[model samples]
Target: MAQESKPWYRSQTKVGVVLLAGSAILATVGGWLTGSISMANAVVALIAEVGALKLAFGIRDWPVINRNK
Candidate 1:
């Protein structure tokens, strides 16, 4: 039997979680400092956060995995 070492970049899950948490913190701080939460800003932030999470999680496209042989 043989074992292969995983690369550091393979820790997508951890990266995603960290990014998500950071996004949340940023959003909260922005809202607090501005004393107002703009819908547009919120939406943009949400989208960016989601995109980052997806990228961090190694999601490049739809379906998450290829089904075709």
Candidate 2:
């Protein structure tokens, strides 16, 4: 029997994670290049961004609610 073909693109979570990581890395690099913000501030900002992303992706699908009850 023939094997089934795999998906061409990566999963949503994987893609999102990569994007988030890359964004943090880029921001850190930019901050370093500017030399305005300290390393500690950059680290804190990265942590906050990651935390927000986690909360966003952790959310579950909710059913629509009717207002006209």
Candidate 3:
């Protein structure tokens, strides 16, 4: 088996890392503005947080349903 050679600067992972940081900052600022974090806002932020995870670590392509072939 051979490994793929690529440049570090143009990596997709790098972009995802940047986006994750941005989302974290936004959530922090939002919580600060509201004086206290509430369940609703926390839920929304959680979703964004998970989405960022998917972006940073690419999701697997698993079939949603089983097909009877």
Candidate 4:
């Protein structure tokens, strides 16, 4: 699908990437400074968070038919 065809809010991949990057940095820095997570663990956590977000955003919303009802 073309980006121009999507709604304004739906076509926000750039914004999403920026938000994810910012959040990852904040989370890593906060946890590292507070001794909650080490630098290595912070890297792992960032990877997991990015993967989860990408998977979530990649899912397509399908319309379900009420055939059983």
Q: What ranges in model 1 sit over 4 Å off?
A: 1-16, 19-35, 60-69
Q: Kindly report which residue stretches of model 4 are placed more than 4 angstroms away from their true locations once superposed.
A: 1-25, 59-69
Better of 1 and 4 by TM-score: 1
The CA lDDT at 39 in model 2 is 86
Q: What lDDT, from 0 to 1, does candidate 1 have?
A: 0.62
- Give the best candidate by TM-score: 1
Tens digits of per-residue lDDT for model 3 on 1-69?
953444433778856676776778577667857868876776777677767755664443112332421
RMSD of each: 6.3, 11.2, 8.0, 9.5
What TM-score would each prediction reach against the true structure? 0.45, 0.44, 0.41, 0.44
Write out the backbone clash pairs for model 2.
none
| Clashes per candidate (backbone, < 3 Å) | 0, 0, 0, 0
lDDT of 4 by residue, 1-22 (tens): 6333343246577457657766
| Candidate 3 wrong stretches, greater than 4 Å | 1-35, 61-69
Candidate 2 matches the true fold with a TM-score of 0.44
Ranking by TM-score: 1, 4, 2, 3
Q: Which residue pairs show collisions in model 4?
A: none
TM-score of 1: 0.45
RMSD (CA, Å), candidate 1 to true, equals 6.3
* lDDT tens per residue, model 2, 1-69: 953333313457646766877688688769867997898888887788777655544433111332322
For lDDT, the strongest prediction is 4
Q: Candidate 3, TM-score vs. the true structure?
A: 0.41
